[model samples]
Target: MINGSTNEFIDRISTCQDTVFIYKGKKYWFQGYMPNENTVHMEIFQIDPAKEGYVWEYNGSSITEGQEEFQIAPIFDGKTFWEVEQEMEWVDC
Candidate 1:
């Protein structure tokens, strides 16, 4: 997952086309934007050990969509990376 703020995630994806994020130990790559839906598309992939070089096997895609604030929603999990981070901070208290 993104280690920074929601804005940071937006900035990274906006500026870099190759930006990827790790969630639940799996890597996801940005596919493109869905202007009609006002959401970004991301595809999940798994590293193929059988490959000689860096190869990714298509796993699936992110089911969540971007919020009005540009924060990508978590799939049925009810928690975004930012929310998880916030909870972590509370646990430390």
Candidate 2:
């Protein structure tokens, strides 16, 4: 069951789709949604000191990292971290 705030958040992200946004000069993209819990996940890429990818689950209040340990990890199996990192592209608005 989704909460009102979560529903609104989902509506807003749907309009942007795959667009990436900059935060503190780093790139991030919305990866997927957890409908049961009304949580949204995002991918944060590391570009300096070698490239890497990190997953953060945003639950309206605070954001946390560690996608592999997330309940939705299995959904993204076979998707190597590097693969996601390489696929990242910057988008305005």
Candidate 3:
């Protein structure tokens, strides 16, 4: 788990250009935070056979060079960063 306050996690995510995390065996790319709603917007990733790498899709639009369909898991669990930190593992990609 992250050993700091939620602010720390917010700071980390805010500064990092590309933040990817693994939660419950799935890869999630951190999009941004919704402070007022207390939710995090994350894009779900899947392996793209054509690109030979991972890719994320938004609203049926591909962000990478692949045609795979993926979903955006906007974390609406109403959990704080500190609570979420316990379940997420940061990926160094």
Candidate 4:
């Protein structure tokens, strides 16, 4: 889990800027994160504007329903999406 607030997570990942990652020939992009209640809202683009994967509001404990849908989101382990992005090569958008 992230060791700090959601904003902190966002700041930490900002160094990556906007980026895309290819996993198993699949493309994923980083959108943004928002902190709500005791959870963090994470959003990522799966297929441009129509498709978004794994858009969720997650607290340190669990994931609850998000405001958006079409979450084909990758498996999130409580870390920021950028943390996951660091593990993959960048793909040009």
Tell me, by TM-score, which candidate is best.
3
Instruction: Tell me the tens digit of each residue's lDDT in model 2 across 8-88.
Output: 333444432443433334555555444455454544344333345554444431223323333234223345333333333
lDDT of each: 0.38, 0.39, 0.42, 0.42
- How many steric clashes does model 1 contain? 1
Report model 3's TM-score to 2 decimal places. Answer: 0.39
- How far does residue 28 in candidate 3 sit from its true spot (Å)? 0.7
Residue pairs in collision within model 4 = 53-72, 53-73, 54-73
Per-residue lDDT for 4-88 in model 3, tens only? Answer: 4444444555433455566556655645333344333333343222223324323322232111121222342554344466776
Alpha-carbon runs more than 4 Å astray in model 4 = 1-16, 33-40, 48-87
In candidate 3, which residue pairs get closer than 3 Å at backbone N, Cα or C atoms, i.e. clash?
A: none
TM-score of each: 0.37, 0.30, 0.39, 0.36
lDDT of 1 by residue, 8-34 (tens): 555554432455554444444543444
State in Å the error of residue 92, model 1. 29
Model 1 has an lDDT value of: 0.38
lDDT of 4 by residue, 1-93 (tens): 222343433443343244455543455565444455555444455543445445332223223333222133345445434446445445543
Which should have the higher lDDT, number 2 or number 3?
A: 3
